[model samples]
Target chain A: MTALLEVDDLTVGFERDGTRSAAVRGVSFEVAAGERVGIVGESGSGKSVTAQAVMRLLPLSAEVGGAVRFAGDDVLGYDAKRLAGWRGSDIAMVFQDPMSSLNPLLRIGTQLTEGLRRHRGLSKPAAREEAARLLRTVGIADAERRLRDYPHSFSGGMRQRVCIAIAAACTPKLIIADEPTTALDVTVQAQVLDLMDELTDRHGTATVLISHDLGVVSSFCDRILIMYAGRVVEAGPADDIIARPAHPYTRALLDSIPRLHGELPRRLPAIPGSPPFGTVPADRCSFADRCPRVQDVCRTNDPALEPTATGRPAACFFPLDSVPVEVR
Target chain B: MSRFLLRRLPQALIVLFGVVTLAFLMTHVVPGDPARLIAGPNASAATVASIHHELGLDRSLGYQYWTYLRQAVQGDLGTSYALQGTSVASAIGHALPVSAAVAVLGVLWEVLLGVPIGIIAAYRPRGLLDRATTFGSLIGLSAPPFWLGLLLLYALAYKSSVFPLSGYSNPYINYLILPSFTLGLGGAAWYARLTRTNMLEALRSPYVQTARAKGMPESVILLRHCLRNVLSPLLTMLGMDLGYFLGGVVVIESVFGLPGVGKLTFDAIGTLDIPMITGAVLFAALFIVVMNLLVDLAYAAIDPRVRR
Candidate 1:
């Protein structure tokens, strides 16, 4: 089957003091129609930058280069009018903070119906009806009654659901949910994730779920891309990668997660060094300074994602074939 | 709504009462003898005493204050000691419309010019527009209004001869242009800077970013969602400045020869027209209190979180 969203050799860089700082360096990935893809990374891993590049929302000074073919269209050069049409209609986003995602002065009904009426050309009354339905579909009880309420009146989880409802209003082909559940409580995160999973599946919409949580990514996403220092270190089927991680960073991350039934004396493992932020794009592999298995060659030559025998691709020269069962 | 008003109304009343009381007593104590100023120096001692008794100036300060307060409450306001045969309220009533008209026109011009300039400056920061507005606001804030009024009068009214130098006119005839604009232009500059600062602050807020992410046009994001958030602070500034505008219009009105309450009050102070001075002060105080109340209500409307 053809890929729904194909990004090839994407690069995003910011200019500061006449020097170029590559925030996201050459990366490639694809999400098949009706599939869920998770991009896992730490704060400065450039995961969010990659998602923003897909939306063409980066600041004008930050140079972006790549082929982003969405539904057989090259979206890199879309003009203002075209970009307006693409957003909330072709590919929408649910941001990290729900409180900020919705305008405080607007009622839920107006915000939800705005996208529907703009893209779908529904009348006000019809849009209002559909908005209420959409709200209910996102698990908001008494959706009609709550339509007139402003964003400030809603709780965090409820606001997130409203954001999801807005993103799903037009049934876009793709939804880029950037850290959608990061600001929520653990219980609320689970609930919102479940609601998103159910709704996206119902609509058969492809999704890019960017998060730092290994458990959520593994459980909710069909595919996972493990990122480190502005580059994707590994990518594969969610179950294969989680159960049998091939990259060292992936293994370290999985080791760091605390299991629910772990023994009392168990110590959580953490990667020793912090990731880099301001560096120019060159031939050197970015993770070399932090990687424990670094060699002289690893510091000089950049590594590209290469297919391994374990049904995935990893950027490291040596890919693990297996992991210990207990660790897995 | 009721809860907020319930709390604010009492506070407003107390402030108004204090303002009237202070204005009445302070004008009397400011080393001015209204009786002497009124009767003139050539009058005999008995004539001066008769004039003092006739004007109730011979009464005790406490009795005078009590009588003035009672008359003021009943809308008498006494007669203007400077202008014979005219009540203080009537003189004020005649001048009120002109002052109110200038103020309204001035405020309208300020909002119309200030808000847009502020928005443009904020939208394109560090650009040519931003730099221009910043320079203009600096000049406006630093240049004394009286001095600027004269400069504008000389340049636009005298040199260029585009507008008249002074006085009120039939608004429909458009003769009030130069003086109204002179009064307005400086305040507009200040308002523009205030609005720009607030707008810039609101634009940086994450909600504006979120609005863009939601596929709303930049115009909608800036005007509808962001402008409302910024207006709460801007409105407060507008209210306070409006109050100042009432008391401070004296020099501008005098330079322009506009017959406003400020000009009347200024003359009253010079001649020690006690009744007229007290009336003008109380009126100015009421204007400020009323405006502050309106601003509080506006604040409640703009930010729902503030409403009771």
Candidate 2:
């Protein structure tokens, strides 16, 4: 069956000072209907850029080379009208910073009802009622009175709830939430995630959840894509990937995550080097410098992601546990 | 609102006092003598002394300052020294509407022409219109008001006869056009630059991106999301420009030969009308202070975040 969203060899580069620097190198993924896929990556992993590329929301200066097919339609090639119709109704997004994501000057109701009125062709009163209903679905009380309030009037958690409500307003086929819970408090984070899960469950919508937290993706997503330095280093079923990470970087990530029932460590374990500024250099394994199990061959050969003996795609030449695969 | 006003009342009074004090000091300490100018050159010493006593110039400096502040507050600006029997208030009252009309029309032209240009330039940065607006604003900002006024009068009024040459008209707006444009062109440059910069920033804000992702058209994103954010600063500039302009369009009024507060003060200064000069100064200062207060109040009304 055709996937709901197929991103094939998606590449994104930003132009600066008359030169192009790749932010998201060739990356591919797919989201089937009613499936939840989590993309796990640290900063500059190009995960956020991937989401933006799919939405066609990047700045004009960005050079994106990829095929993003949304339900058999060419999302990248859509004209202005078709693109507008696709963005909020067919595929919506929840941003990282809820405080900035909502317009300060507009009423919450106006922000919520805009998509409904525009995409669904619902009348004003009908849209208003739908907006109120959506707010209620997101666990916000007194939706009627709160509709008139500006964003400043809402608290941080409430603002995030409002953002979630807006994303789910049109009941889009796919929802791409980029680190939606990172900005919220720990307690609020679980609630927001649960709310998102509930909304997608009720609507039977596919979801692409992006985060830097491995635990977040592992607990929530059916399939997990572990991205590092603008490339998906490892991708497989959430359980198998978490149980035995194929790539050395994923192994390091799993080790870094603190356990609730283990011997308490004096300090949290941290990876030694920072991620490369833009895209990792093309000649060698991107994570070789930071990899704990680095071999001399890793420095000379670039690794392409290919399915392993264990039947999972991993980019490293010498993946974890299994024997080394011969490089061409 | 009441709280805001209460907070501002003392500030207003202090500003008014400072303005009155400055006017009094400048008028008293300046080289020219009001009594000497009022009395004829051929008049005897006795006549000049009597004129000084009548005008309260004979009183102690402190007493005179006290009387000046008191009288100003009670709507009593002393009789003019130049036009003998003309009250300073009535003279100003007569000339104020002309300057005000020019100011209103001039600012109208400014917002009408400047804001849209700013928006268009910002909508497509590095476009031809943006380059033209940048060059135009630099010229407008640098051009001397008198030179521009004279140029307009010479070109549009004198040379082409599109407008009447140097006179007030019956409906008033027709003759006011050349002078108003002269005033507006300079201010329009400022507003355009201010709006363009602010609009550019607002357009780049995350809210604009959010609006775009909502499936709304570019027009809606630009207007409803970006422009509304730019409005507060634009309105602030508008209020301030309006206040300063309303205080007096001195050079424009003079070039057009319209009798305005600026012209009245110019005539009063040349004739050494001390009371008239002081009255005009106080009026101008008061207008600025009041307009600033109104703007602060209006800002809260529009931008709710400020209230927090």
Candidate 3:
């Protein structure tokens, strides 16, 4: 069966000062129907850009190449009119920063029902009913009354739930939630994630959850794709990848997460260098500078994402066979 | 909202009082005697003194101020020294509508022309239209109002005859076009620049990006999402601009020969009509204060956060 969404060798670049720098370079992934896929990376790792590219929501200055197919139809080829129709119905996106995701001037009912009326061809009254129902599904109590209130009236977590409700309003085939819980408090973040997971599952909608938090992704996603310097450095089943991160960068990212039950370390392990800025050379590994096990070949030549001995894809000459002791 | 107004009213009254007191003092302190000017430049000393005594100008400044305040409280702004038999209040009442009409029409032109240009320019920064608006606004900002009025009068009124050369017409609007346009052009340019800056900022806001992400059309996002956020600042500029328009009507009214309060004040200043000057300034201050209050109320209406 064809995947629900297929992103093949997607690349996104932006031109500044007459020089084009690739923000998302040659990243590829797929999501089957109802599958939960997470793209995990730190800030400026191009995971958010990839999600935006999949939705074709990037600014006009961004140059996108490669194919993004939704249900075997090329999403990248859609014109403005087709894209508009394709967007909220076929695929919807939940953005980071819930405070800003919803329009402050509009009432929650207006915002929630807008897409339903436009995409579902529901009447105003029917759309309001559906919007209230959707809000209820997202765990907002007194949904009917709350719909009349503005976004400013809601807490950060509640606002993110409203955003999710809007995204799931039409039961889109795919939902791209970029750092959906990043702006929420730690306690609120779990509730939002749980609500999102439940809603996506109930609606049978495929989800692409993008986050820099491995713990968040590992608990929620079925599959995980680790991005580094705009490229997918590792991809496998979430359980296997989390259990044993194949790429050094992925392992380092996993290591950076604070532990609760382990013997206390003097300080958390950190990746030695910051993420690359501006354009990185196409011939070399972008993370070579930060990699602890950097080899001559890692710097001299780029590593292609090929299946390792354990049957998971990783873009490194020497993939880690087991979880490192320092990280554990 | 009513509570907000009640709280603000006292402050507004204090400001108005300051304006009145300052106008009264400054007109008195200026080295021009209204009685001497009324008597004539070559008047004898006896004639000047008699005129001063008749006009109550011979009284102490404090006594004159007290009497003026008392009469002003009783709806009497005294009589215009320059225009015989014309009460300052009645003259102001007659001239105010003309000035108000010009200012209202000028502000209309400012919003109608400025906002669209600003939106178009901000929608596509560095495009041809943006560059054109930038250049046009530069000229509008730099050009003197009188010179611009004369140029428009020559081009459209005198030469082309599309509009009347000068003076108020029966319907009034016909004569208002050139002068208000000249008055509005500078403000339009200012509005355009301000709107452009505000719009560009609004468009870049994360909410706008979210609007786009919701699959809203560019027009819907620009108009509904961005424009409403831009309105708070735009309303502020509009209110302040209205004050400027009222005060600035002097140049436009003189150029067009319109019998507005602005022209009345100009003529009063030349003739050293202290009561007329004070009355007009007081009226202008009150108008501006009220406008600013209305703008704050409008801001609260548009942005719910402000209501808190």
Candidate 4:
């Protein structure tokens, strides 16, 4: 199967004063045409940075080294003019904060028609017509009037719906949604996720979903890449990873999700320690201190991602072979 | 909108009242007596005393204030002491337009020059153009208007003869240019600094990122999305400049030899003309308040969140 997006050995770092700290370290992943790939991680685990590197949206001062090839063309190497053309037409993003993502000064119609006119070459009337249809497709009623309204007039969930509508406006080949429903209510979250799923299915558009919630990613994405300490710790089919998590970090993450049927503990289970912030020494495992299965080898050596007994790749000195019946 | 204006009216009147009262008390408390000045230093004590009583300067201070306020509301400011029976109202009326011309042109130059320069400077901060503007604005801000006026007049008019020396004549705008430039230079520097700060903030906003993601060009993103946000604050500053501009600047007017309200007030103070000074100060204060009202209205018009 051919991949629509291939990100290989991507490293992103920011420099403050004279010291450089790697935000993302040697991460590699791919999304096949029409594939749904999930990258789940805690804060500062570099999921968002990886996405930004793929888009070439990192600041000019950021020290980036890697290859981001979208549709067999090197994205990182594209010049200013070509980069402008490539974005929003071939790929788009749905950011976390819908409140801040839309321009406060602009009417919704202007914001919507901008892309339509730019990418689709639609005239004003045609773009307006297309924008209204786009709004309606995202389940917004009274599209014509709503388009005239400013973003602040809409509720948080409604604004996110507008954001999704914008992302799917041109029907790009891949949409990188970075925690699209994080700031929404649970009910609205489900609706938004469902709407995204429906739209992508209809267009056969590939997706890269970034989230911290394992439950959200597991339900929406076909494949899961669990990240910790700026590196992908485990990756496999979603169902397999949920059924038998090989990496100890992944196992802890699975244990953290609350379940409805189980005898509830007084306190929810949590990972023992936080993820290392940046640039962990290459000699030792990044997750060594936090791992319940840590040993002398884990302290001494950083394990490379390799295929384990579960038939998926996991980067851990001691991969968990035992299955937890209570987790499911 | 009408309701908003109606509410602001009383507040403006209160400010005018306070300012006029202060001017009246100040002119009264000072050593110079309008009666003595008008009669001359050589005049006898009897003649000066009669002149003081005739001009109603001998009346109690509170009574004079009350009378002036009453007549001012009716647009009746008494004769100008310096101009010898020329009504203060008519004198101020004649002088108002000169100030207006300078102000309008000053603001025009500020918007035309300051806004674009600021936007460009902000685009690449600490670059060559930005560094130049920073140094230039410092000079603009520090140089007194009178000094800047003299320097420009000397360089452009006296030395190169690029512009006519001075005075409002047939080629009216030609006369207005030097004074207007003098007036605008400082404000333009101010506007540039303000625009730079606001534009930088708007550029970093998420909306700009969203615009870039939409495949729009950098020009479109800067002008359409970011510039629109920068304009709100810029509009406020412009309104204030226009308000104060209409009042006429004392230093700019004297240096350029234009007969603006500033000159009228300066002459009034020199001759100890209490009526004219009070009238001019009140006029300027009223203008500022009105401009502030217009700014608030413009604010509501541009920002939808403020409308409700």
For each candidate in turn, the TM-score is 0.92, 0.97, 0.96, 0.97
Query: How are the candidates ranked when ordered by lDDT, highest leading?
Result: 4, 3, 2, 1
Clashing residue pairs in candidate 2 are: none
What does candidate 4's lDDT look like per residue over B1-308, in tens digits? 78888888899878878888887788789897788888988999999999988888888988887888788889898778778879989999999989999989999988888999898889888899999999998998999999889999999999999888877787888899999988999998988888888898888888887888888888888799988889989998999899888876888888988889887887788888988887888888888888988899998888888787
By lDDT, the better pick of 1 and 3 is 3
DockQ of each model vs. true complex: 0.56, 0.80, 0.64, 0.80
For candidate 3, write residues B1-308 as lDDT tens digits: 88999999999989988998999999999997777778888999999999889899899999999999899888899998888889999999998888888888899888898999999999899999999999999999999999999999899988899999989868778898888888889989988888899999988787776666667787887788888888888898888778756753788889889999899989988988998999999888888998899899999999988898
Better structure of 2 and 4 per lDDT: 4
lDDT of 2 by residue, B261-304 (tens): 88888888898888999999988888888889989988888888
Stretches of candidate 3 exceeding 4 Å from the true structure: A262-266, A322-328
lDDT of 1 by residue, A1-328 (tens): 9998999999998999998888998879999999999999888999999998998888778899988989878889788788888888988898899988787877788888888888999999999999999998988889898998888889999999999999999998899999999999888999999999998999999999999988888899999999987889999889888888888788878877877764633567788888887894467777777777778877788878887767688988766677533543
Q: What lDDT does candidate 3 reach at residue B176?
A: 89
Model 2 agreement with the true structure over A1-328: per-residue lDDT tens digits: 7899999999999989877788888899999999999999899999999999998999888999989998888889999888888888988899999999899989999999989999899999999999999889888899998898999888778898998888888889999999999999998899889998899999998999999999998888999999888888899989888877788888778778887765667887888897887546799988889988888988988899998766899998887775432211
Better of 3 and 4 by TM-score: 4
Please tell me the TM-score of chain A for candidate 1: 0.95
Decreasing TM-score order of the candidates: 4, 2, 3, 1
Weakest ten-residue segment in model 2 chain B by summed lDDT: B32-41
Q: Cα deviation of A93 in candidate 4 (Å)?
A: 0.7
Superposed Cα deviation of residue A157, candidate 2 (Å): 1.4
TM of chain B vs. native, candidate 1? 0.94
